[model samples]
Target: MHQCAKEEKVRVIACGAIAREIIAICKANRLGHIDLQCLPAIWHAYPEKITPGVENAIAEARAEGIERIFVGYADCGTGGLLDALCAREGVQRIEGPHCYSFFAGNAAFAENDDDVTSFFLTDFLARQFAAFVIEPLGLDRHPQLKPMYFGNYRKLVYLSQLEDENLKRKAKEAADYLGLEYEYRFTGYGDLTSALTRL
Candidate 1:
């Protein structure tokens, strides 16, 4: 962020679960006058209204006299937030892809290998999900659960965390029978970056 600020002469505004980590980095580097926009985890569960969330965040950023706002994370819940915010606030948003990919692609320290990138990304996501569940939600680490096999992929079967326990149990059974491996996998940002380069 400090490097970008020096080059672009603008402030960096970040959002998502990793915002605090970015803040720590900025503070450690003595980067001042940064406008950070922190949003709720609710958007992760429900990604539909993320446009409004971005709008609200942008409004807050503008109020802070930030000349430019750059979103470092743009995936999962915060994927569309930057676009919505750009449209609403009429500020140009830079093309920073998913968090991992962006970092991996822009990494100047080393010549990244494709295999190494893939391994790191996968591990990173797993660690991230594990941390979120364990630290925030207080969830227990049970056996590695597989997604229940449900044959009717054609049918519009909704699988939400809000579903009743009975329905969830049934879905799980179906997924397991179907051999669905829906376990969260850590994907390194470098993997995404390399994939994009291939394209």
Candidate 2:
């Protein structure tokens, strides 16, 4: 088992997608006792890279003498590998299948079975839709591929972490581009706040 650090402060190794929200939460709560580190947001599309990346970050932090570390990722499509790594390393992570569940509050998200046909986008994703979703999915290169990719998705749900009208507009446009209905949910960091407070 890993030992706790003598220092009272803790480090949070986060997914780059939620880095801004994590920082905002820390600043708003005056959680100077915690530090934050993040891997690339693009890794959201590449689940295979997440485990090693998080492991490397943890090792780096431990080498810096920070024995207390909290992973900011949920299972995040790692097929429980991320959880397994955390278990072996003796570090705790936010509880949920992914960021969407955590941001919407795990219990509420679990109860919302109507969202199974939904495609989700957070603020960061809304901003990077073109780069991350459109281009990467080849929708920009081949418009005919849109239906193939989004055929099963009936709606695009924009889970807003902050009240940004521009991002909402962008999310709506993304839904339009994907030929899906649009929805907006203002979650405001939901359980992320509580998780950080626990640190």
The segments of candidate 2 whose C-alpha lies over 4 angstroms from its true place after superposition are 1-7
* Candidate 1 structure quality by residue, lDDT tens digits, 1-199: 2231333233444445445445555555545544455565435445665566666666766676666665444554455655766666666543444444344343431343422212121222232444432233333433333222123232212212222445444444433433443322222233323322221
Model number with the top TM-score? 2
- Per-candidate TM equals 0.46, 0.95
Tell me which residue pairs clash in candidate 2.
none
Model 2 C-alpha lDDT per residue in residues 55-136, reported as the tens digit of each score: 9999999999989999999999999999999999999999999999999999999999889999999999999999889887
Those runs of model 1 whose alpha carbons end farther than 4 Å from true positions after fitting are 1-12, 75-81, 92-94, 106-145, 148-199
lDDT of 1 at 80: 64
